[model samples]
Target: MDRGAWLFWVLIASLCGASAFFAAGAEGQRRDVRAASVTLESGAVVSLAEVVDGDTLLVATEAGEKVPVRLLGVKAFDTKLEKDVTKTYGQAAVDKLRVELEGKPIRVLLHSTPKDKHGRTIATLFVEEHDVGLDLVKSGLALVYTVYPFPTMQIYLTAQELARADRRGLWSNPAAVLRADALSAEWRRQAP
Candidate 1:
């Protein structure tokens, strides 16, 4: 091929490469923007729409959508238990969380893998910079769930130990504790 023909082909290749590079960058920017809008980053204030259970809540997004958020690193007793003792403990935990969340905007810290298999956002919530999950564990309203890894796992476990020792909330009754522990084990077995 002649020098002019070779030079023309090289120019065309260079333009195509530049176009692909810019296109990729633009796509990356768009993803970043979309993530910023949907993801509840640290310190992102969210209104509590409903407390579904002790460990789950519905939060209202800026787009007027209600999203279910499951508290990361903690598990509360199942509120649907047939046993009166277990049911009472579950209801107490729900009431505690509900009182805490009612009429307040809390800050959400989302995990990298934010959504669970159930499509609930796995997050840690804070109110006035206090870790809500840790508080719940400390109060014995919830147990430390170690099935899924989280940064504050050790702290939550320690808090759970203290709550159990102190006989606080659900830990106060041996029957309730036994039922809750059995339920927790069943949940772990079912975890994917």
Candidate 2:
């Protein structure tokens, strides 16, 4: 090809490349939700690195940025934290969540602010169509975090009540039940 023709093609290609780069960067910054395109209604799919407990986890974006995510509207037994009540079933809770989510791609549904008090991403996580918080409560490994404005609060409340009534999981253990009662009361007092 002639020099002019070759130069013209190069300039067009450079412009195209610049535009594509800028467009990609704009897309990344526009969401401002959680990382990895996690929208409120749809959510982004991410891989679970580990189940921190029934209510918390470590997840990763496709680019491998590890994010701490706390399950919205869930309160599992104490893991390695200072608690007013004893941790009667922490391992059981962890095991359940781990089996369901660890190393698996799960969808994180945004609910409230992107982060919690501890800076963990607060979202409703799902495996396929099953909500992790709802499943844990239904299995009696967790309780509904009763703070208002939580999505699916009523469903969690009813499910937790049924679990308690049926004496399932931690509810079946008297010590755990007692501890949970104290914890609930304490949370109520501390809640805004």
Candidate 3:
């Protein structure tokens, strides 16, 4: 082949390769954009199939997938395992959650890490257009657990502090001493 012809073919091949690369990159970006949109705008609405505890529940999606959902930024009274031995003000916290969300459809927004170590979906829950995490903090059922940046982290934290000062829910109970111990026990019980 002539030198000029060989060079022209090489240029064409390079252009084709570049086009393919960009097309693939664009496709990947499209998928990412879609996923982000879903996570941010459209939360999965599911039925509360099982209650893991006062602050967590197992939700059954419309697609028949059962996912364990941990209420973001809140820890309520422990009520799943033992009925007789209850934490101070624990039953009140559980009662509040039950009144707000039991048997209702809940919206679940995903975080960067979808699941925790126990395979539960770590997400911010919502009911009736209200963020469940924020509600828990406002009601003093849970604390603001900020592991990563979220849209309403600051607001939730502030609300939780106010609730703590007001001594709401478990905060009011003198028996509920030692935040670290309570948290550690909760984690240990939940851990697989």
Candidate 4:
């Protein structure tokens, strides 16, 4: 072959190689996106972006969306509440949730009416096979939020009663001295 023809063929080979390289890179990106979120039979498994509080989480989806999810049957003391005792319990609840969920992938089962008035997704979160909301209730860090009924409402209520009986968490220290009924009413009044 002539020198010019050989040079032309070399240029053609380089262009083909570059095209293949670019295509492979694109496919790798697609695979990464898919790996970010996985769909389970009952729900979607997502990465925890932030634990907003005890009952709410910010989760990342496959499309790189950060969605706020409120646990369907759980309510924790508002961390923003003015009362110091309530705020202490709220902070404890947040700390507990962070320990359980931060830097972990969790399963999210969204409710039928997924969005709340604040546009947050209402979901039941799971770490492996354990229900995160129910666990909180059992530990006395949260109450069974019954405003909107859910399938596990009864279980959550039972857990709350047991926690109260066992004098765990808020049910024990701050709440024991601070009048549980009065604090509960105050928390409910200030709930967002």
Clash tally, candidates in order = 0, 0, 0, 0
User: Residues 109-174, candidate 4, lDDT per residue (tens digit)?
Assistant: 876776677667788888877898899889888887765667888888789889988988788875
lDDT of 2 by residue, 87-119 (tens): 646667888888888667798798647777666
Model with the higher lDDT, candidate 1 or 4: 1
TM per candidate: 0.72, 0.72, 0.62, 0.69
Per-residue CA lDDT of model 1 for 1-192, tens digit only, reads 999999999999999999999999999677544533455555678888888898988777666556678899888878896857767766887888888877787889987778777667899998778888898899888888877767888888888889999999889999878976886787678656
Candidate 2 to native Cα RMSD, angstroms: 12.5
Greater lDDT among 2 and 4 belongs to 2
Ranking of predictions according to TM-score: 1, 2, 4, 3
In terms of lDDT, the best-performing candidate is 1
Candidate 1 versus the native: TM-score?
0.72
Error of 1 at 20 (Å): 52
Cα shift from native, residue 47, model 2 (Å): 0.9
Error of 1 at 164 (Å): 0.7
For model 4, what is the error of residue 45's alpha carbon versus the real structure, in angstroms, after optimal superposition? 0.8
| lDDT preference between candidates 3 and 4, better one | 4
**lDDT values for all models:** 0.81, 0.78, 0.67, 0.77
Question: Worst lDDT window (10 residues) for model 4?
Answer: 33-42
* Colliding pairs, model 2: none
lDDT measured at residue 12 in model 2 versus the true structure, 0 to 100: 100
lDDT of 3: 0.67
Clashing pairs in 4: none
In Å, residue 125's CA in model 4 sits off its true spot by 0.4
